[model samples]
Target: MLTCVTRGLFIQLVFDCRRLRKMQPQQPGYSSSRAYLELIADLPWQKVSEERELDLRAAKESLDRDHYGLTKVKQRIIEYLAVRKLKPDARGPVLCFVGPPGVGKTSLATSIAKALNRKFIRISLGGVKDEADIRGHRRTYIGSMPGRLIDGLKRVSVNNPVMLLDEIDKTGSDVRGDPASALLEVLDPEQNKTFNDHYLNVPFDLSKVVFVATANRMQPIPPALLDRMEVIELPGYTPEEKLKIAMKHLLPRVLEQHGLSSAYLQIPEAVVKLIIERYTREAGVRNLERNLAALARAAAVKVAELDSTLRLGKEMQPITTTLLDSRLADGGEVEMEVIPMGQDISNTYENPSPMIVDEAMLEKVLGPPRFDDREAADRVSSPGVSVGLVWTSFGGEVQFVEATAMAGKGDLHLTGQLGDVIKESAQLALTWVRARSADLNLSPTSDINILESRDIHIHFPAGAVPKDGPSAGVTLVTSLVSLFSNRKVRADTAMTGEMTLRGLVLPVGGVKDKVLAAHRYGIKRVILPERNLKDLAEIPAPILAGIEILLVKRIEEVLGHAFENGFPLRLHSSL
Candidate 1:
């Protein structure tokens, strides 16, 4: 049976064909109407059926073969495929892969397409500010065309293609409209069955299409749009996983591209590890692949040079018997005649000297390491400085909070592009410190007088990068206490938690990311809110093993764990 849309389009095409037949051959409307009729005829009205069964085993193998270290993402895709196999007509939820760049989010989507035996289409939503770019411009406008969704279907000539909306978080909005808001109707499975494009002027069935979106961060995505999709997180790779990926996938491909074999150019395990640790630091192998390609190009040049030298007839002379005897005899005892014994060096060109990329070679090729944790460690080694862990869009990072006091009017200065929440946190921390100065051993005389006579300044480094959130509450308080009492915080310690007015440590989000950040910075100890202890389960065991995790319910407990000594003797006695 013909659907309403098909019935209407057929009727319209019949009328247009009759009108075009009557019109003159060279008339503009005649040719245009004929073309429109052909387009309407070619529209794919019927849904294509997958004759082959959904193969879970083959799908798993394909995903594993294409990508590495996205175990949870692969599992989720497999589960979806399994459910899909059981119920063919079920509409799957839209999957959004969230991670930093080069972590295989885009490639994973392609792998999904291959697994399901569907055509893949990619539409980058980055910098797409106009809503028309998504829903498409109306027919009333000049040069109007179908939206990306409809266009993708037309190009693939199928209804069940895997459509990837890459960089969804980067979609922009202005006076035109919100492109992200336009995606709400398209992403929601219930509404997408009759997905309407403005130019198409007909309801297109998008229920069968598998929509996957990728983003570096989730915060920029509209909440309504975010709610429609199931998010799968792909965190940064571990050193071991990175090395494996390089050896398994990247090395051979790079070798083949450079026209060199692994025998002629070898990258040892230690060298690959050095490349990962020093040359590039990212959650994915994009940069790692680039580094490997560079190494391959360098090796290719050496091979080319060796081949050129051999072709130029530059052969080494073999040592004569007289020369060997002269070398064996005493320095001034024998005289030897030097003669050229021609030995073709061309054979050596067949097996070029293997290029071994070590730590020193990596330095020469990729320049110095991008990050240095030692400088950060030394900066936070003194009193009035404390380390705070933060979660950013790129990934987790360690931020240093520094506080200093001087004799002046009782004014507190806050710098470092701190957000309002963080500024409020700093103020609250200062108030808490002032109120408890007597117990904290921060005041030699009256607490009020000590605070009133001094000016306190708190600053977070990296002044250009905006810092926010309530998570820095404990770190700020510790910095204040250390500044006032002349006690240094533990150099290897880091803390993250919100502070209440009554000295309670409140829970903060991103515990796993913050802990990972701390671990990356070589922090030996971490103080977190007791409520976030469950988040520790999400972190890997190896990362957790290196750090001492102290779950604290109150600010005093944080102080005890953060400082080198459990607090000052006087404060300890008072407690």
Candidate 2:
């Protein structure tokens, strides 16, 4: 019996030893988890206590370390956090930063992440169309994984990372189902706490995450989704802003990035400003950054091309803006605008030092301006055509609305991709004009018959873009009235407001952008809603300085500003 028992015990012991060998790898301090731990260690996850969590004040100081202006944006961030603190939840709502690309949206996000005591992660959602992208794909037949949010959570190994959803509006939707719909649950305050992943089949608290989204156009955003976000507008940087950014941060970094230090190269302020206004035409400094990068690359390439020649010569000469211009001169001969930046020495070389990029060279590199406000300057006179200030997704634009009476059926013809509201506006204008036709002392009943039978075609340019909104009513009325009356609209003026059938000019929104657009068009006079006058302080001083802004309480003022003499109806005499 003892021998039999010993044999059984020996067999069990061999089995137990095999199990122990397998279990060793699963231990807390074992190799696999330890490997993950080591990975966390090697990363820049930890720093000296001295450089630890920066307060908002310190972060602001550091931000000033780079960007010179954008004080408003800095103030806005502080205000946002203050408002968030008073909210019911500790976590703040998502902030959607809307603006043209390159105006520092991503950088600002990074800055905010640093300002707050949080980790940062940016997930680009440009072409994300699948619902599975935001909500984890179910794990069944094949290898499935968690959504981007969950994956990002795993990456930072923390619940609260400042997550930037880049290009949220640009994300696509098709038969796969709108990925945006899945995000509704994630973005919603109440439901996000118990957000469940399909693969994990476990509820994860994502509420701690500070979410941010960026977009070029705010309109394309799903209305339901947009409601969850607190939007911040990052307007395109002005020429001055770009100039400041280039001088403060971009030029120095790009110099070192190309293996050229400040001691070796001197990029002039005029050269920087030239690049901002000429080479980069964005509301942001991103393109400025790209061109700067390109210029550096070109310089490096030339430096290499001339390297062999330099070896045969004596000393290296620093490149100046003038030297740069001369080297890159289109005529093939160096111009005086370019100069050398290095210590003066006898230098022998086959080729001159490359340019810092001249105005002409900038055109070749960055191409011509994508837009022109010159249309505003194109014409000085119009018989009936007038500049109507219209608001758009980009900003305010001055639209030319022309009206003419043609021999056709009394049916009114309208062109331009106008929406339902705009079409109604056109109709409303006709009604208002028809009622006042007799007051204008028209060709009596005979002219009224001709006017009724005549067809009027209205059009808005850039037909590819869909146009809507009721603010163009006053312009439509002025155009139609001018067309019928053969009166001229003021060439230097532009106007925007909604007109009620009662002839009251209702105040309109987007007043600031509209005024800027008008100013861009070289408009010396602007007819805006009187109620909007209170908002004038928001308009930039540079724009308001050049233009004569007139607020109107009635459509009478609009008509007064539009015509040199007056609307024919108003000009009617008591002879």
Q: By lDDT, who's the top model here?
A: 1
The local distance difference test score of each candidate is 0.82, 0.70
Q: All candidates: CA RMSD in angstroms?
A: 7.3, 11.9
The clash number for model 1 is 0
The Cα error of candidate 1 at residue 22, in Å, is 7.5
**Per-residue lDDT of candidate 2, residues 493-553 (tens digit):** 8888998987789988777667765654557998888888887887768767788988888
Which residue ranges in model 2 land beyond 4 Å of their true spot? 1-54, 66-69, 80-89, 141-143, 171-175, 249-304, 311-374, 440-450, 571-575
Candidate 1, TM-score vs. the true structure? 0.86
Runs of candidate 1 exceeding 4 Å displacement: 1-6, 13-43, 47-51, 308-348, 406-408, 444-450, 569-575
TM-score of each candidate structure, all chains considered together: 0.86, 0.74
lDDT of 2: 0.70
